[model samples]
Target chain A: MTKQTPLALWRRPTFWPVALLALLWLLNAALTPNFARIEVRDGRLFGSLIDVIHRGAPVMLLAVGMTLVIAMRGIDLSVGSVMAMAGAVAAQLIAVHDAPLAVVVAVPLVVAAAAGLWNGLLVTLAGMQPIVATLILLVAGRGVAQLITGGQITTFERPAFQFLGTGALLGVPFTLWLVAGVTLLVGALLRLTPLGLYVESIGGNERAARLAGVRVRAIKVAGYVLTGLCAGLAGLIATADIKAADVSNCGLYIELDAILAVVLGGTSLSGGRARMVGALAGALIMQTLTTTMLMRGIGQEYALVIKAVVALLVCLIYTPRFRGALQRLVGREVHAA
Target chain B: MSLLRRNIPLLASVAVYAALYVGASLAYHHFCSLRVLINLFEENAPLGLTAVGMTFVILAGGIDLSVGSVMALCSIVIAVLIEQHGWHPLAALALALGLSTLLGTGMGCIIHYLQIAPFIVTLAGMFFARGLALIISVEPVPIRAAGHAWLGGLGIPLTGQLDIPITALVFLGALFVAAYVTVLTPIGRSVYALGGDEEAALLMGLRIGRTKVFVYTVSGFCSGLAGVLFTLYQSAGNPSAGVGMELDAIAAVVVGGTLLTGGVGGVCGTLIGVLIFGTIQTAIIFDGRLSSWWTRVAIGTLLLLFVLLQRALTSATGRRKAQHVSG
Candidate 1:
């Protein structure tokens, strides 16, 4: 890695994601009145920016996990379904019987981890392709969750359980703090440990990584488990916020959002690099864009269209060919002038 | 044993489809009837057509996740033109199919030209199509024109109690064309070559870019046709129509012994796959003990089994190839 100076850091590929987030913030500020305002309403922070961070917390958690997974040249498309399953498990525990709060939270996380282990096993032992292996869960996980909930959206009234979603810390939503904590922890773990280097080597070339004695299978499985844990936490937050488990709609198409956020963070989906902060910034951009669209009274359908355009634009910008073409175009213009 | 090992995937698919049909027939009296058989094809015609397209894209070592959304977009466009804009049904359909093909070509361009992943491009395509469908009409629009209604009503009686819908015929027609293309055409061989090994195919001087774009366009056309079939079946164009349909198409292709990694499947297998899917759905309905959600679970389980089977087959063959080389 190159020596990190302020200028070097700003010129890094990861910096683009943060810059994109800042640009979105500026756009939001311009388009929406008082977008930057933070008021102490009932001792709670209330503003669009705070709301973006709060609403973005779940995706940020997912992106944090997703960044690592994608860095290993693998993807977990089942994360959304896993989220639904986790949320369903939590809601079922709370709504059906008087389960202990600890059990409610622990059971889902454990189950999610187990689900991730299954994905890891399929990929590692069965030697199945990652996309196909995870796809099985993607299709069936929601069905299993529905089975657990008996096809009903189970609602829970436990205030303690709800606190995980709606509670605040120092006038900020508890979810924001949870996201920050998780991001920091995962970032620190990756940055400070040999695991990060192993992941990069494995993704860069699996055969070579194995030859290098990186214990590729174990590292890959661990990456998946970490993603599962993150997804479980996100699911818990979602369930607590709604006070219900919607097995069918909870985390619907969220895999797309998570994957998009990872890609937007300048992490190549083809793998070999991990950028946690960039992924967090990407998540914030998604949240801010959506919040801005909603605030502008744009319909959900239009917002989706805008999101598709943004996704395409971001993808194009990241492509070397597109960048080269743009540079050539500018060069020609300069010469003509 | 070698013969069995060589054809295990194809044989397995054929056996599973047979077993399911036989079991469903034995378990339910009505399921054995000709009317029910015809109804299966009619009900799943759209999925059958979409799977045909999916097979081409997958066989070319790429995926098209936008088929479901493209179908919905086609339905919405056709509905808006014929119902709201008072355009001719055929004209509306032509426009929709053309637009869908254009959309696919655009996605294909991004995939090949920019070298972005197919999944990402098609994912954006999915979002764009679905959003356009919703923007066109949030509410379901009933197509009430006489020509449209007549087209939707086209059904030919097969037996005293059995009738084949136009959509089923269309699906069969598409299936034949896809099968012919995959089995007998140079383009099809090129697709398989591309999927089997992209670098080798490029070195072999295959038109990788054209073939990739062509596959996506074919997928788009099939999706558009499936949309028409769906409109006929439902008699309305709903934006939410075909939600999760792409998964079903992918499932059908995989179950038909089409490797998700591509280059090892054909449309004949896809036909059986669609039939098997329909049979499962029908069995679930006939069982009355399980909810429809069980259908998804069943598909997922089948997909996993097939994927594992493929892995086993590939490894065995790989080992044999190595042995042969060494010997």
Candidate 2:
């Protein structure tokens, strides 16, 4: 009997998503004159590409974390709220205590990490479902953020803080580089080590994985902590981008976008497998779609409709059932005609 | 005792409701008066109606995150028709309901035929419906006609100092109908069956797709009815009126002891859930010192407590069964 190799296995499921992203990139570049122009002046990046990268940074960070969490057969709907909470804490510390720059930055990150640990504990120790556990934070964290901000926007003017979002290195936004480095680190941890294999096995079948002696609880907790850390980083980028902590709108509906990115990256929502490169490509495609629609002067309402329709179509194409039906229909047409 | 054991969630919900009423009465002496009770119902009638519909959907092992947006869309449609097209209010309401039901059917078809996940399908529906609402009217439309005022609280009456709001009566009627369907009808049993196990239900000769479509249609109808009531209450149709209302409905359902996983809940439980939720908001307001943020914190805490309790109950039952087998 013939044996299938790992290369062939990778080629089967991942090929379509990569090709789709490439096509989208080509379409965007062809439609817009300045879609790819990147320039640096006085150590700051300036370009439409940079704008897309900057806008995509927070979402990319969340999606990276989301990919791992989802691979463990769970989802975290509270990442957006976590981002909001982290931003609120950072802003509050700065506004109230006149905390040093380092303290202000580090405090929120610690809070976010703790929040992630809480989620992990509830799911792992208390045996609550992931969705229900995260739902608590999703509902309450925003209120906590609002409370900290006293229902008001907290604005700041600090160049050192803003540099995280606006600064550049080698003609790329600092946030973009940060995202790349983090993505590489996460990718290596999941790929070049045994962690990735363990995660996939657990997602494939939790009971079987447990029988095989995997520390399922530890891995799941680690995944959530990682997600929380990423949300912390995203919060920093978002707060810096606006230079104002608007708790009301910061990171709203972001969970949906991050989930879409993970799904578009060829990761199954039902869990098991994940792809870091695919997620990056997915992030790029989404940003490009949004930028293209804005550049075309489409109304926000219609733009949203278009995005929903496109997302539905992508999901349909990626799903195995739809692919099978399409292949069967093609075969029938060939036979009948 | 057996009945109570089987319906612990319902009993727990009622206990919470009674506690809320008592607490509210103690905090605000005026809250015990019939006038305040009527006012509370009037204020929350729209949400109560939507929650009833949400209850049905959740019981069927699915969710309708688009209800809020659907309500907004209905409100906009009715408002635009009456004000701009010079259509009769009643006719406009019917048309709005029909359109919303059609939208719900479309969603059900996509979920059933395409095998798309219900969450993603409803999320897309939420976006599409919200976008449609914005397309219809970016700003709120005030109802200037005198006749429309009756839609809010004019139709119903009560004894001196005990007036019933018209919206509340409408909500009560809808709740009655939902209760009848869920408790007495074969269709309701089929819905629960579908939720419990789709494959098993099919083997038992239940029409899974039809029941699902019907449930969503009912939910859409409730949302449409809620929109009309809201329009009457506020005396206007705001395109952004129902933002985040779906989350509230879901929260209420969960608190009322409905399993998010599905197959076990009733409209009565949902009513108690909605009352408890509304009471908490009112109590926080009555206390006067607590921040509005307390409402979120309270709901979140309640949700966690109930979820933990559910987990414990299930595990306890599991361990008992294991013991039975071992013995």
Candidate 3:
């Protein structure tokens, strides 16, 4: 093989997302005062940059699973609700049952996985569209969480549980470590096994894969179960960070963010291509955008507007029709010139 | 029998709605009162209007998540203008409705022209409308317009204790108009054709762009109308009002007997859906034991049941078609 060169890396599709993220980071550093300022306090790193990643941990975790799900041409809109449910389960277990940390964490993850399994069965067995299948949970999952928490924001304070949110293991945020570990573990699993290829094949063409003897149903269910696990962990992080599980508000609109991140990371909604690093960068880009606006003293109302504009711009840029129109317009000018 | 089989979903919704009303009438001593029955129409007037529009959009095989945001925006614009700017209620309503319809047209243009997903385009619309509304005023604004109150006051008296409000009358008028349009109008037929199969419709010389745009325009207008009527009904316009109304409308449409895949349901089913929705809320309120959140849970369960029933019906038809082909 030809010697790998830095210039050759530019051909990679993932390079653009990473480069965009870096450009955004640099812009934040230049514009927002003290944006690049980093501090070490109590042996833990702290700063706006750190804060963005720390806050973005939940989305980053979600992006990993969402990448896989979207690669399978399916979406899990219930991630936000699953987050709420998981958080509620954890909070109730801690506050009401006075469960240990292991039980507090384990039970919620299991519950979240069960919710994923429900979605999987609905889509695969019921043969319902993925959107319709997940829409059920999206609608009712929050109510179930409210039922569990008795329609109250359940708060629990256990030092170990809180550490998952607040504590540091090695002068860095625990959330960062958790995210990194999960990403690496998932990445390794995807790389070292045929699971990723099977997922891609399933997304590329289900009928063909089924004809080839792939267990499409089982694999699809596994993808959802994986997403559920990710959502569960994200929920635990959110709840632990606040020490309260706000049933209605804990993970509101997060699934939208994750979907946007996945899309931004260059995952096709039509299925078959997955990007891990790109999605991570996309989630980071969102966090950075929100932070940059906050630091610039922009009103909260403008944030959604900004997000809409960015999303629209990205959508336009990605559409082949729009691109063709742009090229024809430019080519016409060039011919005239 | 074939017709009935084809519309099993619709008939099922009616049966559920009727059963709920009958069950409530039995469970609660005064549930059958004219007041409660009229209140169902009154309370659900806005939702009914939006869901009716949503039915048309879903029928065309597209979804509009921006309805709630558009409603909130229109409501806010009307409130800000009529209350804060001393504009006439009718003038303010016209402006708000115009702006909302324009927003819908813009979204529809993008979705049609750019070939973007409806979810993404409407999501952008949702954020844009909600952001604009929030920027207008984060606080709730109560209408001080005398005309709003005057219209609110005009209602047909059935009993000494109750009268059908003008809001409900507006909804009923729209419902009749929509039903007539859906059944008789070429545009309505075009919408159904486009929804059932866009490729076939296009090949058959349907104006795909116009139909899609028209569907969104109607949805936008309906949502704006709903907001205006709701403002008159609630006497206030909250920027955050109808935060999740689109999902509720979608649920109502689905539960009322429409498929999300489009071209399989009607506005009448949507009305039954709204009535069912109102019945559940009112029944829970009367029961005193059920919590507010249970309304959502109950709706979800019903939605699931209806979906399964639809699935079974469709599969049965599928089997029949297969058997016919083999024979």
Which number leads on TM-score? 1
CA displacement after TM-score superposition, residue A193 of candidate 2 (Å): 1.2
Span of 10 residues, lowest total lDDT, candidate 2 chain A: A4-13
> Which candidate, 1 or 3, would have the higher TM-score against the true structure?
1
Name the lDDT value of residue B132 in candidate 2: 88
Q: Per-residue lDDT for B170 in model 1?
A: 93
Give the per-residue lDDT digits (tens) of candidate 3, residues A78-164. 899999999999999999999988899999999999999999999899988788788889889998999999899888779899999
lDDT of 1 by residue, A1-337 (tens): 9886566665587788898889888877877899988899888899999999989888999999888889989999899899999999998888887799999999999999998899888889999888898889999999998999999999989998898999988998999889989987988888898888988888899999999889999988988888889999999999999999999998889988899989888888899888888888888888888899789888889877877888888888888888898879888999999
Report the CA-based lDDT of candidate 1 relative to the real structure. 0.89
Q: DockQ of each model against the real complex?
A: 0.80, 0.69, 0.75
Better of 2 and 3 by DockQ: 3
Per-residue error for B15 in candidate 2, Å, reads 1.6
TM-score (chain A only) for the predictions, listed in order: 0.94, 0.92, 0.93
lDDT of 2: 0.83
After best superposition, candidate 3 residue A38: deviation in angstroms? Answer: 1.3
Error of 2 at A251 (Å): 1.1
Question: What TM-score against the true fold does each predicted structure earn?
Answer: 0.97, 0.95, 0.96
- How many pairs of residues collide in model 2? 0
- Winner on DockQ between 1 and 3 is 1
What is the C-alpha lDDT profile of model 2 across A7-75, one tens digit per residue? 744346666667777787677788887777767677777877778778889999998999999888888
lDDT of candidate 1 at residue A334, scale 0 to 100: 92
